[model samples]
Target: MTALIMLVFSLASLFMFPLMAQPLSLGLAIMISTLLMCSLASMMLSSWYGYILFLIYVGGLLVMFAYVAALSPNTLFGSGSPLLFFSALLVPLSLILYLYPLKDFSLMTVLSDYSGFMYLKSYGSELISPDSMSILIGLGTILLLNLIVVVKICYYQHASLRPFNEV
Candidate 1:
């Protein structure tokens, strides 16, 4: 029940990220979402795994925040409608999940057969296995591509990436 609630809240906050008025608010949303994900992972896998994952996520977020804070300006304030919408959505989703007979589902049965808890334990193990080296390399490649993209976007003189200058 707690995990479901966490998932819902995280997802709702994720949806609200773009609606945030300030860059700080967006960063807060991102941090909250990431923390919620970490918590969920901790429940499914292990505390150690979640803690390591969270540390990595927070480290990346801090670096990204530094870049964005130096680059992005505070734009116009956003409206409150999305908050209300998320609130409405959260209640019903929670209720449905809470009342639903989740045990009866075949998916849960299969997951239970694999070291319990939705196969997350085995999945985490597989991630550390030799067969998963490609996954790690793929993640590195993605990071490299992201750096290349950011560099490509940086050379242009944009009002967003650079602070204002007075004549």
Candidate 2:
């Protein structure tokens, strides 16, 4: 359980690394972060949930990413120094974090004992429960809403998003 928490934090740091990047790179980072988070969730919770989330993120988000990539100005991003600095900073933080848990194994054991506990399980079986179904449906609805919002925001009339029609 401690390991899973550590893994999630590590993946979270991976997500933060992309904030220094351009939009395309940031989108890629977000996708990678989603994948890593999904994998971690799969390990901690259920494989199907993780798999479904990953698929939804990739399939639904890629179109929006492409639209932004096409519409956004191609600025020359040269933020290499910050990336290096973040790497140096994150490595020690992760190591220190990992060491902290090793010093307290009793807490880890207690957390592990409760790994199977979830509010949804209080309702019914995990696989076929209304909680799980609602979660999946909610995720899909959110993705659809996001897609619509992105499409709306990227109007062709907007100067930033408009394509050049001149020959």
Candidate 3:
């Protein structure tokens, strides 16, 4: 259920990009909403420690999003800004940190291995091309990560909650 919601929001974010007259604002909103929803669901379903870490992660995302949104194209730090680039870095970083507690190296390795291939197609494209392949890759990565997390949570929950009769 949570995975579905995350997937929906991620797809929405991708579609929203092309329609954004103010890309920064729209991107910020979509990012914040995505982070907020993920964190909220994690808090409700995971341990307290997980909730705390999720909150911190979401906070950092919000700060970075705001920073990117504040810079003007003419400002010293503005044109061809690295803020979005940095935010992209955060996606995989947060996934690694969040899943580290699970100690599921197989899942992490799979995600990491595919991460480069997932975005590599964009490197060959011309800068002026209106195709938002990078955005699609970013969204896909987030959805994949969310699915892994949800599966991990469900597996553990089922194991821990099993009744003595079932055991």
Candidate 4:
């Protein structure tokens, strides 16, 4: 039940992304939503997975925040009527949730009951196992490709992201 509520809140926070006008506020909202999602993942999956997810998200967020802060103009953030907007969104969300019941699909309860199972003994070990090698390779390949693409994009001679003073 708690996990379900957390999921709802996470979704709500994600929905609020478009409402944020300032980059700083948007980054804050993204961080909050990522935290909520990581907690939800921890409850549903393993704590290790949640921790990794949070670290990855936060690392990417840090880079994005640095770039946004450097490029965007510093503007005073005006207070908006968030209470009214939140209430408006909350009422509809609550109505939908009430109309459609959600079942607690968290795996923690099931795992706790059969704690001695051999197959489920170690969660992280499967990543390095031979059976999952191809998946790992594929993920690495994708990441490498993404890195190359980003480097290529940023290396354009006339691009805004070029070296300082044409170094």
Each prediction's RMSD over C-alphas, in Å, is 7.1, 7.4, 21.6, 7.8
Model 1 is weakest, by summed lDDT over 10 consecutive residues, at 101-110
* Model 1, span 26-112: residue lDDT tens: 667667877886776565446787789789978987887778666655566567776787787788767776777343233433554
- Candidate 3 residues lying further than 4 Å off, grouped into runs, are 1-3, 18-24, 36-50, 73-167
What is the overall TM-score of model 3 with all chains considered together? 0.31
- Note the residue pairs that clash in candidate 4: none
**Which ten residues in a row are the worst by lDDT in model 3?**
72-81
Q: Deviation in angstroms for 55 in model 2?
A: 0.6
Question: What TM-score would candidate 4 get against the native?
Answer: 0.62
The CA lDDT of each predicted structure is 0.60, 0.54, 0.43, 0.59
lDDT of model 1 at position 129 = 42
Candidate 2 total steric clashes: 0
- Ranking of all candidate structures by their TM-score, best first: 4, 1, 2, 3
Candidates 2 and 4 compared: the better one by TM-score is 4
lDDT of 1 at 166: 83
Error of 2 at 74 (Å): 1.0
Taking the tens digit of each residue's C-alpha lDDT, what string does model 3 give over 73-98?
21222343333544564566446545
How far does residue 40 in candidate 2 sit from its true spot (Å)?
Answer: 0.5
